[model samples]
Target chain A: MTELYQKQRAMRAMRKAAMQRGVIAVLDVGTTKISCLILRFDGVNLNDEGEGVGSISGHSGFSVIGSATTASRGVGFGEVLSMRESERAIRTALQSAQKLANIRVDHVIACFSGGKPRSYGLAGETTVQNQVVAEQDIARVLSACDVPDYGDGREVLHAQPVNFALDDRSGLADPRGQLGERISTDVHMLTVDEKVIRDLAHCVKRCDLELAGVASSSYASAVSSLVEDEQELGAACIDIGGGSTGVSVFLKKHMIYCDSVRLGGEHITRDVSMGLQVPIASAERIKTINGGLLATGMDDRDMIEVLGETGDWEHDRRLVSRTELIGIMRPRVEEILEEVRSHLDAAGFEHLPSQQIVLTGGSSLIPGLDGLASRILGQQVRLGRPLRIHRLPQAYSGPTCSSIVGLSLFAAHPQDEWWDFEMQSDGYPTRSLKRAVRWFKENW
Target chain B: MSQINPDRYTRSDPAPSLWSYRLLRLMLSPYLRRMVFYGIPALFLVGVGVINITNEQRREQVLTTYSEMKTFVTERPEFTVNLMSLKGASDSVMQDIREVVPIDFPISKFDLDLDQMRQIILGLGPVKDVDVRVRSSGVLQVDVVERLPAFLWRRDDGLEVLDATGIYVRTVTSRLQYSNLPLIAGEGADTQVAQAKQIFVAAKPLKERLRGLVFIGERRWDVVLDKGQRLMLPEEDPVLALERVIAMDQAEDLLTRSVKAVDFRLQNRPTLQLRSGAMEAFREIKLMQLGQIK
Candidate 1:
């Protein structure tokens, strides 16, 4: 737990240093594509710097001055499988984007989608030292949370204080300067397998750059895809990417739960290639052009060519009805949606005030996905697009770039983590039993 | 009207119709759908290709014929800023602006940066703010908001006119130009025009004997008189207590007597320093009163 706290503090310090230097790059390392967005800070507006996005300040105002994407190589299921191949791909994307922006950036905030994310909601409370809950008390209460030994091979990725309560009053966003006898806090902690992070850090170091910050791709996706009201009330953003589907639940503009599934669009592509007896490239093209779930009588007559390998002439070309193509794609798409539904159920997503599901990502562009998702997930679903920013290229403004753009937003104005609050070392006890007992009493 | 219920009509379950299903499938079929998606872009590419092949020869043919007309249109005087004009400015400040910002006429308005010209015009001393714009009629319009003179400040260097915000409006070669405004004299008096103005308004009753107000150390005021009397005012609420002094003078004719100076820095004990003759008379009267009492 102390190591986890120290790592969070180190990341915060790096983020502050990177922000003060002005320009930072955001890299979204996905299984299918690696995207880089160079963000010029332009110095924050002094009057309203700390206020969250959707205003004229924060990361939403940053322009994607330089953006370049390359086909990902040596990445499988959103983790780096080969260091050399991934490093080369990262360098190509960063160099081309930096060349376009005409400024070299050394600090980068990277996001990844793998390592099996798990979420926990922990609460702790502390007495108000001076009758009024000051910032120090808030920090002490947050530090006082008993971080259950979340296994040996895992590390904390995001720990956010989602809600605060002062004595009998609950749902307090900020309790400082208020008179209260006790201050209670609920912090949402997301941990991932540590080996995946070490691999990513090594790959980044090989590219001759410093990793200023790290964020979960699922959390970043929700930040970009969900509308302000949807996030404030409560909604789930399911980012269906190439090799994985990321599920994140945001409430009060904070990510309270996040999980990732191993199945994604590439599996469906594999299914199409194997079912239609065609190459993977041809399968990808045909799926993107002609894939859907709902088919009817007229689709039985509509035929599409299954382009084959060039070696054999007679077997090189074949024709299949659109209904057959839908027959192969529908089951797989439904399987993915069902898996997402189960993950949502496991996260207690139904208890949220609003259960609107927003589907975003490259694979989410499949026609009739929202209708199918509604049937399975049983929520008011809508196709999510990244909130429009100034000067963003029309090409990169689609659902595929949601995670990267959200990473850019996260880089500019990170949410207030536990480390942001100032803690007094002299007065704070080092893991006392009385505080743990108090936490259990207040939370349970 | 047959005992209708809205729930029956609004039910989510719609009876599956075969004809609508066939229609939806017809629209959703890949062959027709791909054409619906890629047809426009295919047609656009073909159109662009044909145009590109024909445009080279078309440009060669037409460019030779239209060269003279192109030159004639580009050289038109209406498209250029030929006759420049300045509005809403006095003659002298306008002349100063024109001299500082030298412009070559018969130039294209696209080449002119209006913001730079606005900054140049605003740099003039009396010009508080200015707006430089180009009219569609081809005349350059310069709208000026000149700072008005608020007070006449007499200093060791020279007399100058100060604006309401204590900014120097213009230098006065002679005091007669702004004699109607209240005159202030001292070092740093131009920075305290608002305070000096308040004191002058309070001393309006002593207008005839009032010479001018002198600012002391840029903190307080000294009301000078034509008969060489001075009133030292307190730093805080000087104007209100000056009004009180004016009321006292109106009641007792204090200014007409042998008072050299009045000090009101102390709110409770306002001391009037009398002249030598009055001081000696006061001491003799005090001594005679003491002997009588013994």
Candidate 2:
């Protein structure tokens, strides 16, 4: 019995050590670009020396050994538009990163950005069989979650037992071996588009990479953007991208719900393109330079030069007041915010303990955007940048890098799944948790 | 002019139809015969329908029962247990449970408890743990985690095993197979079980270094080293106090040479109490040791 117990502990220690040294590859399949980073870890030893002394901590190796990114093709609104083009793009990125790291990368975890995401809070209860809820009972309650029929083409991306309740008692973190009359559990199920999930998986497979896991882009963004306190309490992460805006709600360090709006920075660019009568590329530049939500003191006397595509040098001139630019930018941004508000409302955002809103992405960099968003959101709104990384290239450290940086962290410290619990049936005498009922009786 | 009874008008009553044939003859005509003939068959059909429906329900129940039995036969544990004795436990309680239960095997395989089972068995001097669990179908499962026979502590209430946790495992026979353990007997031994548990947990790293532990007061503990000696420990912050003992082991060849006991019941420094009960040796453990506690 002692030998059996000792062997079990030894195996667990070995598994934890093995995970620290393995190579992990991340695939970020966005509409604009497909980035891949192949990281070779030196194992997770708590006594590593660096500037990352106390800031970013734990077993996900804080060592950055390799990274890579490439422009995306044949992808639209977060799904692969053409399999061949997307496959080629992924191969290019992976090969480029592998070249830099001087290593062969095989396994990959990809983050998806599209799908009409909805949140459902389901709860289930069962009686304690042995006068207590043991580990088996916990597994039973989670399995009894009816295996929600998330349509024919969809697959369950995440099914987590968020909170547990014992009889009339609430706020139980770990209900294992605890006694009560009835044990109830709150399960949060997240589903993704089957076609999208499968196609991305196929793309990775085509690139000769095993699909280790899949996470939502919005969820990955929240990981790097939201701080530890925000994650512990609750916060909404809004990432406005090139072709769409993704919204994710997090509490207790896990994403409870995620959604996306099809309108993004491109819409704002299009609005400027029409208002200033310039090329689409020129409108983007002008928007970056002159876009603002507030235009109170701006003078009509201030003029802006516009470059048209007429090809005649004399005709390539136009002027517009700052007020006109504000008029064009304000409505589109407000429309995007309005759509995001409905998304938050529908996901039951009010149930969260904290109502802080952290906005990220390239579109969030507009001047006076926070005040406008705060007015529209009716909550504390602040621009967010991904935290917890060292010696980050200056060009890659911004709101836009939230998902990529978060992907790095997520790959490093993936949570232990159900199989991590040891349920060995050997020579040791296994005792039932019947006496746990004494706790309830004593408290009553 | 009383209205005829429904039963008297109907053929369901033989008395109304058999003797009063003349009156029934008129009622037995085509119009009346149609009602009588069809009504009887319809009643019979209803009866037959109910019988068939009930038979089908019974068959379904049998099928479900067979399915469950198949699963149990395949999944239930195949345990090897020998029945030692049945004494204090009530046979009627076992009988009432066995009426609906399908344990399918003989009861002689498992040990049965009887008599004042709780007091007697719990009073065992050697046994350490008792765990009991009940299944949903009313089957009781009992597991006993026993301790090695050590010492008999005489207390006012009774004798009990001073386990690693310092709690009473049980108390009964003092003489048993387990040896190489020191014994301590005194008044107020019941209060030392929890302290003993702390000592066992704290001295995990010093496995071979430990010989035996004795209760000094209930709040204090006396630890005997491998060479047959003792160290008295104080109640307050005993962990730090044990660290001091570890330091002495390094400064002096404390664990290497033979000595009786070291008393640290006082906070300042450890005092030695020499009495070579099991091993023979030395003056003061000449300090020079420089090995880790592991």
Candidate with maximal TM-score: 1
**Whole-model lDDT per candidate:** 0.83, 0.66
Evaluate residue A421 in candidate 2 and report its C-alpha lDDT on the 0 to 100 scale.
30
Clashing pairs in model 1?
Answer: none
> What is the C-alpha lDDT profile of model 1 across A1-444, one tens digit per residue?
666667777877776666666667889999999999888777454355433323222332466678889888778888889887787777767766776776667678899999899999999988999999776787789888888889989988988888999989998887778898988999999999998888888877766678888899999988999999999999999999998999999999889999999889999999998999887878898899998888989889989988777446455567999899889898999999999999999999899999999999999998889989999998599999887765778988899989998888788768877766665465446567678888999999
Please give the distance, in angstroms, between residue A395's alpha carbon in candidate 2 and its true position after superposition.
2.6
Going through the candidates in order, what is the number of backbone clashes in each?
A: 0, 22
* Chain A TM per candidate, in order of listing: 0.92, 0.82
Candidate 2 regions exceeding 4 Å error are A1-21, A44-59, A299-302, A312-315, A416-444, B1-294
Q: Evaluate model 1: give its TM-score.
A: 0.57
Q: Specify the highest-lDDT model's number.
A: 1
The 10-residue segment of model 2 chain A with minimum total lDDT is: A48-57
- Model 2, B1-294: lDDT tens per residue? 123233432232111222232333334345556667798789889987677567978768777998888766645454322222222324542332233232443332223342234334445433344444433343445444455434445455555555554455455454242344334445554566555556656766566767656665556666666655566778776666776777778788765654566667778866766555422222222221322222
